[model samples]
Target: MTERVVVDPITRIEGHLRIEAQMNGKQIDAAYSSGTMVRGIELIMQGRDPRDAWAYAQRICGVCTLVHGIASVRAVEDALDYEIPPNAQLIRNLMIAAQYVHDHVMHFYHLHALDWVDVVSALQADPKATAELAQSLSNWPKASAGYFADTQKRLKTFVEAGQLGIFAKAYWGHPAYKLPPEANLMAVSHYLEALEWQRDVVKLHAVFGGKNPHPMFLVGGTPNPIDLDSDSAVNASRLALVQTIIDKMRTFVDQVYVPDTLAVAGFYKDWFYRGEGLGNFLVFGDFPSAEAGTNLRDPGSWWIPPGAIVDRNLNEVQEVDMRADAEIQEFVAHSWYDYEDGNDKGLHPWKGETKFDYQGRGGPDTPYKQLNVDDGYSWLKSPRWKGKPMEVGPLARVLVLYAKGDEATRALVDDTLGKLGADKRALFSTLGRTAARTLETKLIADKMQSWMDSLMANIKAGNTRTFNETLWEPSSWPSEAKGVGFMEAPRGGLAHYIVIKDEKIDNYQAVVPSTWNAGPRDPQNQAGAYEAALADNHELHDPKQPVEILRTIHSFDPCIACAVHLTDEDGEEMLQVKVR
Candidate 1:
């Protein structure tokens, strides 16, 4: 008999997610991914002023807070044909670059590392041996035996007190864990260090946007005012502070994050061969130059180019046109939604509907043990590019750049692949997805300094403007306007579609990265990225633990909170449970 294993509310991710897999003994026969909540942000955006949409949209997720705000304003600007000042563009680049470096590092160390590094195994590690191993990886200063011993002691306290806190509820001694004790100790030490480092890194966002977790954004340009003499504005002191934060980000990524990933990866080299799902990849492209008349999606000007790669082919990159009819679409056939035409039909974002037509096992009052996968299940809608399921995130973005023959991307990717002793084809698997995030983090972190220099140069040349007031009024817009605002967010490609009529939002739909990677099966019964990857040659060392399943899903850094945003301020809370 085929056995089914369920892992509900997968820990360490941004939102609630449940993964169910059908197993033929030890190997996975098939898998299903479901988002348990429903988001009404799209419906809430309707009939609101387009200028204020960013404020509401940015609340989609507190983790990826700023990305929605940036995409929202860009959509309004795109619709109005409004152009921001060159200085404003440079500032936006700096802010976004900071977000990528900050968010990617956090995801690797805090969210995904636990799946690979066995914390209980760290207790068996010799501090001296761990220090030696850490020293060999990089010149990170906290590699002494004393540092390792202290972290081990702290972990021991948590375990002894029967309160692992953040480390609680993990499958402690799973057989699938491949890291040695010393390596686990090293990763755990860095994990704590990353927490402290991130606190300082977010200051850069506050310097530019006035705060973190939901930075302020203007439609035509950035909200920050540049005044070298004014202490209240983005003056010389704040500019220097931004540079300092950038330096710190570069140091941690080079010294800690990259080195730790390689060290752990050396022990789990087999992961390079598994979890390669939907070889098709997509990126909308971002990081526009401050130069006059530069297009954001222009391959030559963008730091990360926008394109699509089909069948793992790197010879030619197909252009991604969001505005192209039927180029991008969402399917709700297997989702908890109903389309105006039919559940089987796909709808473009501009004409997207948010009708909730849930027909699951229960009527939303009581929860079911498992989702009814045959009909409507997930709140997430399957997103496809030109009728093909595509993977998005760092791996996709890096591959697109590599295929475009960008010098920096090719060199970094080639060097990393060489160090791993893996071929270019290895970039298609779970390990590749994890490693790509580190490589892209370094790339974006390094570019931040150059952007800072450019911003300062523009200010020195007497260009201090950061906002364009000409298009700030809704009266300046046409009676009807529609546009798409897209960006390469930390998780992957994120776009917000907006339809405005008479200066208010007629309709708005946001297709985030998780929607593409974690949605349920599509209209043609095509498995989404998460489901497909989990079913791709996945084997369970112990079905009771299911660590192998997490390795693949966490590699995508699944963020279902972006997909479904329902919350109850006053209601009976359900007791959380762990399923295996």
Candidate 2:
């Protein structure tokens, strides 16, 4: 009899997942990554105003919800042909920059660090020796005895404060977690500090967006008023504080992010050589300029290995391949849908339908190899990147942007490489992706500051009208307007397609970062980004210790909240699948 190994309630992610690995002898023959639960945000968006979609979309994922808000608004605005003002663009850019910096720091230190560094190990490190190791990297954040002492006090408080989720049953002394105790203590101290920093940086989103974990924004323009009646002046004092935060963040990134990554890399050097999933990447560009159709930092020229991997041809990508729609379509073939088109053939999501039936694949032998409809594994529909499995996330975006090679991006990249003691050859691995994010944040931060200054100049020059009145009548919307808004979110390329009728959302479709990273097998039966990375000969010492897998996956920073929704009884997935 064939044996099955299952990993349920996958930890260190935003949602619930179950991994079923079919082990043949000592190797994994096949693996199925299943999202255990469903949340239907799409179906619930059905009669809602297009502008309101941003509010609901942002709720898709708590961690990267701002991206959802941005993408949703961009989509609606794209459909309506609305042009936001220059000042509004700068504000959006700044907010996005803040999110990128805050998220990257928090992700590296708190979420992903536990895999490599042991907390308990910190108790044994000589603070002096650890400080020495930290010193070699650059400006070392003081790892003196006093710092470690304070770290111990903070960790103890964490334990006492009953907020141990950050350190839940941590494998502090595990073999894989091989950091010096002092180094560990230093990292731990910053871990607490990063929490506060993240909270502070997220406020940038709050100022523009009503709140985070989902923020309110406008399609035609920003919600914050900016006319003579509105008192929207740049708070120089507050802006100075933000500037200070950016500076401190730059120091932390230089001292802590780079150094910690390197320190951890010394032990986990294997990741550099492995987990290079798909090699093909797509970053649809990010942070559009004040002028429409003018790419300030062209994503077409990325720093990473560039080009789409459909059919395995490596070429510079200037535009989206319209042909991708010709071959790829989401499959309910194995889904609970009983409708004709559920498994019939490829159809665009706007025209896609869902139906439910629990009969499995339908054949004499089908029952043995069929998917259950009653309680399906995931609410997410499988999205095929060019009719094949592909990955999208930090790595993909960085690579795509690097390949495009905008002057600003390349210059920033070179300076960052100089800092990391790396060359172009090293840009294709996990370490490269990790290091690139921090560098990108700094570049984006500095650029945001420049953009803010430019905005103020434009305002002083007496130009405050940032929105165009493009209100189209429902009847005047033409036969059908099919438009796509492509943006680079914190994870990677985010896209939205909208088809409207009678001032109502007829069909609204999105391909989120997770849809690219965590997708299942397509018609070609290829491995997804995560699957391909996991397939790279993992040295599975313990089934419970999926640390390596966590590192590879977290490197992508998969966001499932916006990408999933369940179908109805006939196997048609619902658009709005909630956590509760």
Candidate 3:
């Protein structure tokens, strides 16, 4: 076995992730991605009442708060063939669209932007030059020398105080950071603004779902019902508040987030050449039309069409069926679990198992060392679409839309490519992945106004319905019913599979976006997207600091749930990650 480079619990992301790579001198030969934690949310979901399953399943990840809850309820609704009303559908669409806007913007500025923008470098920038850079990009009101100078002063204080705060533990002053000092200063100022912007933007979720971060969800449709006069319900005041929040979200995304992304990508044009992994993409279409609910299985009814693109071919779009047993499968061969039949055999989510089978390796008390890369070293199962590793997330969704010849997606993709003076092939790299997320944010944020208007129109038309009472009771369900609820999450495709037996959840499994992008190798030795992207380029200029790895992995916006605190026999904090 050759010695490899390891980054245990890669920082500046949502969860704990360890990356080990076998290096061919300066470049990576083979790379490995480990979850470094176990998620038993699927196991905990068994035997619970199907109606209450969303509460437990949504707790899977605080970062992806409402996606799990929405998926969980959709699974049960699909099983009973419950059709929600038009008003309910519009409300749900608003929530989902708001999630895309809020999450994508936050990921760009707070989570992923630091990979390109150097805060330390911002201190050396001329505030006037930074103002010029900002004003040239957009007419955002915050573009002023005084604003940037104040931000630079804050950075200096952070450095002088010997505590970097949110800017700590990063690869500051690294050669990989190519953004000019003025650009860095401008980006840093927006970074601080985004932190406050997200706080105000997330209120849209609270208006309909009752609260943010795992908001209330009903199995049939939506929790908040439209009543123009009632304060307890989604009244006129709450509706106005939601509208204001959506406008704020769009303003930030249009003026600050999108401009900053294009600016950062300009300096890292080399990233547009590499970071292509597997080249197989998947997306379960989301934001379905209320009329499409008549047959919820049709992808044509969805705003974002569901399809698969293989080997970087854009002309041929392969149809994806979440209901087919042969379509979506998970392998535990390279994971910590064991399938009763065979480890290598692929099992659909309906029959997926959550058996913990860590055999005497990397235990809590075991002396820590290198991961067993040749064997199971991660808790995440390798999810495949029809026996192939598929990359899911922003990049996949954009390519699928562009291949389907969506006019809006094409205009954005073509415009971004033109601005960078590159071809369509540039969309397959790390910069492309990050840029796609920003474009998708614009597409969704802009469309949210239409949804809000439709909801108001429904109420004025005397159609103030939210939840469907037809299948609210478990007694209405069949003795045994299995269904899959899928959507294009902020990160990528997310789904929750549920098997109901006698009104109880017999089996439940949620294959999140992070699992599809961050899982380890399969039995056939096919690498997941993370491993494949790391080997695409020698982003590792120095062995000690691998900013390239963070840039690529963070582009996926990894949400491997949250991290578990590890400690010695004495109770004390072992690790602490500064969250912005």
Q: Please, what are the lDDT tens digits per residue for candidate 3 over residues 1-580? A: 5657888878877778989888888788888898876677776777888888888887788788788888888888888787887777888898889889888888888888898888899888999998998999999999999999999998899899989988888989999999999999998888898888889888988888989988999877888878889979888888889988988888888898888888898899999987887889998889898656524687788889899999999999998889898999999888878899989899999988988666423445434556667678787889999989989998999999999999999998899889889899899988899999999999999888888888788788888988776765666668999888788899899999999999888999899999999999999999999999888975479888988888888999998875333323232445644312
lDDT of 2 by residue, 74-180 (tens): 77776766667777777777777778888888878877788777876676667667666666666764666667676787676666676666688566555667666
* Candidate 2 ranges beyond 4 A from true positions: 1-4, 24-29, 140-142, 156-165, 227-245, 293-315, 322-324, 327-329, 334-339, 342-344, 354-377, 407-432, 469-476, 562-580
Candidate 1 TM-score to native: 0.95
lDDT of 3: 0.85
Which scores better on lDDT, 1 or 3? 1
For each candidate, what is the lDDT?
Answer: 0.87, 0.62, 0.85
Ranking by lDDT: 1, 3, 2
Give candidate 2's whole-model lDDT: 0.62
Instruction: Write the residue-wise lDDT of candidate 1 on 460-538 in tens digits.
Output: 9998989886765677678999988889999899999999999899999999999999999998999999998998889
Better of 1 and 2 by lDDT: 1
Task: Give the poorly placed runs of model 1, Cα more than 4 Å off.
Answer: 292-300, 362-367, 562-580
The 10-residue segment with the lowest total lDDT in model 1: 571-580
